[model samples]
Target: MVLAWNGADPSEVGDGSNYELGVWYRAEVDITITHLRIWTGPGEINVTNRRGRIWSSGGGALAVITLPDNPGDGWTLHALTAPLQIDSGTTFLPSYSTGGNYGALPNALNANVPSADGNLVALSAANSPTGFNGTFNTDPETFPNSGFGAPFYGVDFQYTLGHGDATPPRIVDTSAIADGLQVTAAAVVEDDEDLTGLTLRIDWGDGTDATTVTYPTLQASHTYATSGIYPLLFRATDSSGETANRADFVQVFGADASSNRLNTKAMQQALASHAMVLGNFKTVSLHEPRVRPAEPLHVALWWSTITPIDASGLAVTSARVEWLLRMYTPGEQEPQDEMDAIIGDATDRLIGSLARDFDLDDHVVDGLVRMIDIRGAHGARLNAVAGWARWSDGMSRVVTVTIPVIVNDVWQEGAA
Candidate 1:
């Protein structure tokens, strides 16, 4: 609700006549004034911008109105209807026959306004809605001493600025984690766009999921209650409204008590699958090839990997592993090579031996079946028939395919 007055000085009367105004001049183009008047007192003071903004009180600070650029002698004829700081109105007319230079003021509108306390209010100006900000140190108005026209009404205005790829997700380690211990298991989530918005989720491989998790720093310490394998999954999102999800597997094997009884050798090759089954390898009996052992019991193998972990990338060397296969007839006091021959078939001769269960902490029937299997799908023995595959499972895992040792008429194999 910016108002304008069109004269250098307020209309004043000293003795018999009112004060005459100065010549005409332009302020902003297209705006003009012919008659103007100024009286003292308070009245309704409205402030607004392009749209109506319902506003609060001025608190006595007046919405100082501006006068026209071309002030003339007819200014004194305009009369006031109200006071200085309040709402008041008085129409002005041209003194001469030529009439005043402009038409009447436009409609009163409303707009949005804010208080000095930072609270927003509704204001009206030209019957539309907009926003207005109130400042404490508003500029004081000064009645011009001498000028062709008055200044135009203006308000300070200020404007908020705010500120994310197709990067695909990747799988780092599809392995498993142990239980009852603080295992650092995690994956990294990334995006082609802004990487900040990407969130990481952890499925803990323990049958529970947590979306509040994030990646690149996946360090969850959840212990499994029982001994089993667990699989972990992860997903990511970007700021550009793009999402890339990735999932890797991990296992968390548990025991009756947290101890180091697990075979670390076998665990290295195991991949976690849905929190179940770790160190995915099997063992049994088969007739394939025995490099060092006698022809009585041969060995078959299937695996993959250019260089096995033990081979250390082409350092090619033999790996010896121990097998505890129950001789078809244990404690018969016969040599292992002879027993392997006496043993018969696919029907019932072979069994998942737990013969040592009769005793405590001691291995019963044992055989040293050396194998050539490396580490991979094809190289891995599991890729072949599930025979009594005997392969190394530790740092120095060795399967000694015993060559027939007939000493002093006593054909006895090495004690495992």
Candidate 2:
């Protein structure tokens, strides 16, 4: 993804009158490259190994004009018939020249790029039409007092890791533990390229339906209902259907009713149910109500419990949990994704009104309030109870509520 030349400069030109101009780029380690961007016209453009062996050519029929014709002014992308693996430190010389007199398009020129390898540009003696056949650094050469001010031409390149790599993803780590009611198994998956759309399948040895998932995230977790020593298997498959797997990867032990703790399975099920309910709402445009693809929502749940005490502990408060919900609009890529974040404040009019005696997770409650306030048709079904106390010492139980929300991407789509 690196560009060898500056793209922001608003100037571009072909090799004026000169027979040829080229840059010799030294490759670092072995690289598999697919294409290079160059400004070309009626003449030929070519790549040669350190020994000057032709590897790729844009034109044919070696008249003076050997490369293909470029019809436009900007840099044109020329695909190398296939990926070529070049060894490290190998000098790759890419050049463009005038085969039929400097008419139409010459090679692209980045006039004053001081960082260019000045030694790589070779010129021809006057009237020497052959490429790179003449003098070096003598034709209109600008050698500045500062070593960094010499001019260089422009070139860009692209490479891919999937070129010749056939190895499958490897499982780096695995762990399992009994959390409340279920056994949670986690695995860390990795690949040479760590690319997207790789399929991961988790086989919970307890005969549960194996889960198949695809995402770029390396960490994955699954919970089993009942527990014994359940062996787990993780299999990863690339787009090429080449799969690498780890068998009997991990063993998880489940918990029983006697394990005194908040029910993890119940908590997971509750959160999953809430996620499904929120995902069911269709996006409604503020101008007109219409259906569109639903955006992805992330739900996080955290909780803490307190031990209720009394001579007769019949009215014991069990636990308190918080749910945080987020929505990612489609076409909103990371790093460049624009987000409108609304921090939930105790004094914010819209969310502050919802603060009753019930102690809601302020963060999650604020996100829910913001989700509903966006410009669109929004609705929610919520139930809650204020702090209810039933004790001689008067310790109130914190009430929790369920709130489902759908984030409409109508604005994002319009912006796109």
Candidate 3:
């Protein structure tokens, strides 16, 4: 089933106003509408006149149904006798009559509502400043021409793809096995329809072209010359072009793990086994101990909260957590370069909170990786200070950890 609006129910309900209320929407691809739905308030009565309707851009009624009385406080679906086929990019309105109390969320339709299957309820002001979430003040059902405050009136529809495929391919599981410098990746994929033409593509995330394979042969291998952590992306596209994607990570260890050098796993294990708790969070750093000058120094830092750390007071809805990694010369007081990121802020692109990303129990470790350039440096004496800070005051809420950075002396052989 496909729906134009997938958000939670509206928080507010209005009085029993006899108005025709609905939203205007379009689909990315051709779709067939099979049912219309409305939100009925609890203990709502007099539902005999409750009607569901679909109107074209020209105010022509395409489909109409008399909704059955439902006193429940949730969505109620009403099937249409004949499925209505809507062309792509065609704008239409799906509405219901508010014979009794109705549910609405003001300013909810300010942005477009897009379903995973490609149907979209455009912004309330897309057509005109007063056009999308329409309302007509009349007892009889009619095409609503005026809108108010971009409110969502709890009207939606169920649809299916015109191509007859109602479901997309699913990537059930993914795995990556690293053997030395080579990593083998595989996935288990299934589709509701036939999998005759299913295609699987793997992006090694090392700036290489993705590897594609057909169904029943969903495995691929890649070899890297350097040791680092690589993210593996798997995407499966079915015959109908419906796709599903999954991601995993592969850590490659270099052939040499000498005293001066440590592998990715070794560094991670060393940091994890140690009791390194900074304030309310624990951190682990993984990187090669030695790197060549001008080469990208890949570092992955894992952190989780040891306790409930709230940067903002209880009065604020949310707070920000900042992560900083600074590189400095040994015995120096200043950093040569640094990287910082802020989370839990309104401007954050990442979706989640400190509690969501890092469980207080610290069972799950969330990590961030960065590549720092060490150009013009030839000595084996460098330091990296990593820690977290409070975004409000720019102060370190967590104790910082200093790791050694050793640049190999290969670049100094021909330099004077």
Candidate 4:
């Protein structure tokens, strides 16, 4: 729908030709134009020529052409030479200017209502009037002053759709994440003209309603309410009425023993997601040292970045991360009772360290621990132990286990 002016319709026609008059409109969506529907005079008007043109915000002309005159007046559809693409919020002037040979081209005056868009003026004072000599301020075309008063002239101009190169927006792949965690869904969309006019619609496929966004980036995040497979669909449309679609899948899981598997891909994904919570680190390496049956469970996490560890953006440090990994994999022990004491001490030390050195809270630390349990549920459980010697010295160890957590330069922190 176009040209719905709120004010009362005008009783008589206004002047056009000579000094050009056009209506300024802010496009709500990207649009491509082939012609403009301009309402003319109510009485029989003789018109040898009609020009439909557009000007940039700076009073520079972008496109202008002589339109074919249709018999009678009410709405005249003026065809354009080339398709003009108009982006949302881009201000441009669409009007009909007079030619060398002055003809009767009456500008239809709608009711003088305030412009719908703040920018609803008919003429720009910056452009000087032109005369027959093709020069400004010459005879017959004196400069128009005081003509630029407020309550912009009532003019009716609506755009007709033209050919637009509308391509589907490409939805970026989301990283594997655990349930209750936010995952950002991003996309890449472009057009022959400005991309700002493109709108993206995301259907999360979780039985919820779909969402639409304009000029969207890959930063929109959604947290799955439960663990399951979600089909992702994205549809992108441009102002010119062109559209495209793409589909993808997202797998979400919760922290459960049944969810943990000895799969290499799953292990890598889980570890990467966990390490990412440490904020922006330079390098990350997850290693599960071969564990003896009764020996202390050990997993090594090594990460570094070019930036200082204490930098404002880099919140996690090597010391803090070491303490976290220990909590997750503290290995099994011979006597379960004795093992509990060692685990208790380790937990206390973690809290003490935070209280004394790092000003962090128990609740925050507990949240991190929960993330580890859920993200690494499929991996071997690490039992907390004081030392290898604490294990029964005479017992023979039956099995060895290993888990690797690796992160490279591509690591990024998830939404807090």
In candidate 2, the residue pairs with backbone N, CA or C atoms under 3 Å apart (3 or more residues apart, or in different chains) clash, namely 44-67, 58-68, 59-67
Best by lDDT: 3
Q: TM-scores, in order shown?
A: 0.26, 0.28, 0.39, 0.29
Q: Per-residue lDDT for 130-217 in model 4, tens only? A: 2011111112122222233222332345443233643434433433233444455666765543344467777776778877877745
lDDT values for all models: 0.26, 0.36, 0.56, 0.41
Could you give candidate 1's per-residue lDDT for residues 1-416 as a string of tens digits?
A: 11243212222222221221111111221211211232311111121111101111322212223332333333222212222221112111111111112111121112323222221111233211112111111122211122211221111111001110124444434333444533445555443222433455556545565534543444555655564333444545432234544444433444442332222222221211210111111222222233323222222222222221332123233232222222222122246465444443321222211121211111111111122222322232311122243424211112322111000111122453
Candidate 1: clashing residue pairs, number: 81
lDDT of 3 by residue, 138-255 (tens): 6559788876667777888777677444488888888888888899999998765446557899988678899999977999999977766665668898654678877566666677
TM-score: the better of candidates 3 and 4: 3
Q: What is the Cα-based lDDT of residue 160 in candidate 1?
A: 7
Alpha-carbon deviation at 56 in model 2, angstroms: 4.1
Candidate 3's error at 217, in angstroms? 34
Of the candidates numbered 2 and 3, which has the greater lDDT value?
A: 3
Residue-level error in angstroms, candidate 1, position 24: 38
